[model samples]
Target: MNIYIIIPAHNEEDCIALMLESLVNQTLLPKKVVVVNDHSTDNTQLIIDGFSSKNNWLESISIQSSKEHIPGSKVINAFYKGFETLDKNYDIICKFDADIILPKNYLESLVALFNTDSKVGIAGGLAYINKGNQWIYETIASKNHVRGPFKAYRKECFQDIGGLKASIGWDSMDVMLAQYYGWVVKTDKLLKVKHLKPTGKTYHKSSKYLQGEALYKMRSGLPLTILSALKSAISKRSFLYFKNTVLGYIKSKNKNIEPLVTVEQGKFIRKLRWEGVRKKIKI
Candidate 1:
């Protein structure tokens, strides 16, 4: 499979080299690796250039953006910038976070899954974080859902989902949208990629509200939205997270934010959410 990987980096000098090194040593090397260095005041560009010079397939581009890292829009914008630099010849397209370390066979394994299951639209390895002396699975989200840090999309599926959304919940949105379009999204529990930094660890306080906004934008009505908010609160072990999420959803509704999915699609999403809720209750 012809795979192309894009890394959206902002002031990631500390860990970018380790990430590039992992890709460079991959058993299934990507056809191209483009790192979009988004206004890094640090030595991020230097690091990318240093590696890029050695391998012709690896390259980097510099672009300007706000210093403050806004959740959904910032990274997606960078991904698109890198996306425009490549041709439409790849079999799989990956949007990788700059802080993760992949095992040598990570891409090879995921590509195998894609080749094995023709219906599979998006597939990726699970992420693990280091704590004390060991790295364990990051259980923030379900293993069934593909984490945003390591999302790899089959070409047709990528096109079918209308690329990626700029709003929050894009990672989750992509999977739901893919399922809506009759494509399977799979995750390999065996392939545990090392996450140097976990999600939302460095995000601003205001970023928390974006989660609810995302749920609303995806047309997850009050019930599912509340359920999701509560689920998020449990995951983070904070009642405030749930409260803020509900507030965020209401705020988005008041602002009359556009929904990311169609009315029909929303119906499907709601059904899916309700089914999961029922299953959990039945258990």
Candidate 2:
């Protein structure tokens, strides 16, 4: 498979080198790798340039964007900047973070997974963050979910879902939309990737309510949005998360923000989410 990767990075001088090194040393190397240097005041560009100079397949592009660490839109916008430079000749296109280290066989395993099943539209490994001294599974989401930090999408499936949404719930929306379009989302527990920086470490406080807004945009409806918020609060053990999430939903509802999915797609997503909830509780 002709795999291509786009890494959206901002002020990641501490970890970007390890990430690029891992990719260049992959068992099955990517055909091309583009790293977007999004308004970094640090040595991030220097590190990327050093690697790019040594490796012909690796390259970097700079874009001016807000320095504030907000999620979703900022990162996706940077992703498109890198995405625009690549040709549409890839079998698997990956949107990876600058702070993660992939196992040497990560790409090779992904290719094997895709080759084994044609219906698999999205495939990725689990993320493990270093805690104390041990690297443990990041519990922000279910093991079944492919983290936004490292996602690989088959070209057909990526196109079917109209690519990723430039919104707060873009990561979750991609998976739901893929399933709605009959594409299998697969996660491999064995291919553990090292997450150098824990998720949401640098997010601005103002971005807290974005999660609720995301549920609203996904047309999760009031009931599902509340349930989802409660689940998140419980998982993270933060009541503020629950409170902010509900408030965010209500605010978006009052403003009547445009939804990311169509009515038909929203219905499918609602049904899918409800089914998952029921299955989890053995209803």
Which candidate wins on lDDT? 2
lDDT, model 1, position 170: 92
lDDT of each: 0.92, 0.94
lDDT of 1 by residue, 1-283 (tens): 8999999999999999999999989998899999999999999999999999999999988999977777888999999999999999999999999999999999999899898899999999998999996998898888898899999999999999999999778998889999999999888888999999978887876687898899998899988999888887898899999999999999999999999999998889888889889998995
Q: What would the per-residue lDDT of candidate 2 be over residues 30-65, giving only the tens digit for each residue?
A: 999999999999999999999999999999999999
Error of 1 at 151 (Å): 0.6
Error of 1 at 149 (Å): 0.4
Residue 191, model 2, lDDT = 90
Model 2 lDDT, full chain set = 0.94
On the 0 to 100 scale, the lDDT of residue 207 in model 1 is 87
TM-score of each: 0.98, 0.99
Candidate 2, which segments miss by more than 4 Å at Cα? none
Error of 2 at 60 (Å): 0.5
Model 1 error, position 170 (Å): 0.3
